[model samples]
Target: MYKTIIAVGLGGFIGSVLRYLVSRLTAGVDFASLPLGTLTVNVLGCFVLGLLTGLFERTGNLSPEFRLLLTTGLCGGFTTFSTFMGENFSMARNGQFMLMAAYLIISLALGFVLFFAGYAFSAKIRL
Candidate 1:
């Protein structure tokens, strides 16, 4: 339990840092007059989670602690809902109606699709 906790903590810390760094790097890029940071992190996190899930399954036995570290810790940390919300709100406040709408639609649709695809792929391998 302690090991799992530690692994989660470490992974979360690293993931959060990476997210921040990416956000900073893309801070200058104005995407439809919205923050590109949140979008980048969400998309990257989803892709990484999918890849990691596949790799983890094919590679062999992984301790529960390691799984927790990668899935709950790294992926959870890497994705930023708060930032996403903030960006949406900011867009609305700035009167970027079209951008806000696009962001909301894309985020929801793509997120769901990616999640389902990841789950389906993982399930297929398991079966």
Candidate 2:
């Protein structure tokens, strides 16, 4: 039990740092269109989650701590669903309704695609 807590905390910390780095690098990379930083992390996190889930499902013997660390800790901290919502809200409030809507559609659509791709790829690269 104690180990699980440590695993989750450590994983969360790493994931959060990685997320911050990604955000920093993508900060000024504006294509003058979408929130690329958040989109990138969210999609990447989703892909990783999907791949791990696939591998876990295939093995069915993953440690509980590892599972929590990867999913609850890493993915949770890495993906910014709250940030995504906030971005949408901010864009809408600032009267960028169309951009907000487009961002939502593109993010959701691409996220799903990348996640599926990762999962499918995992099936082929079984551990």
Say which candidate scores most in lDDT. Answer: 2
Q: What lDDT tens digits, residue by residue, belong to model 1 across residues 24-107?
A: 999889877656788877877776787677767676678888888887889889899898998888888989889899998888
Q: Each candidate: RMSD to true structure?
A: 3.2, 1.1
Which candidate tops TM-score? 2
My TM-score estimates for the predictions, one after another, are 0.80, 0.94
How do the residues 29-96 of candidate 2 rate in per-residue lDDT, one tens digit apiece?
98557888999999999899989878888886889999999999999889999999999999999999
Cα displacement (Å) at residue 26, model 2:
0.6
* Reference-based TM-score, model 1: 0.80
Model 2: pairs clashing at backbone N, Cα or C within 3 Å: none
| Model 1 per-residue lDDT at 85 | 90
**Model 2 Cα shift for residue 11 (angstroms):** 1.1
Candidate 1 CA-lDDT value? 0.81
Question: Which lDDT values do the candidates have, in the order given?
Answer: 0.81, 0.91
Query: Number of backbone collisions per candidate, in order?
Result: 0, 0
Cα distance off (Å), candidate 2, residue 93: 0.5
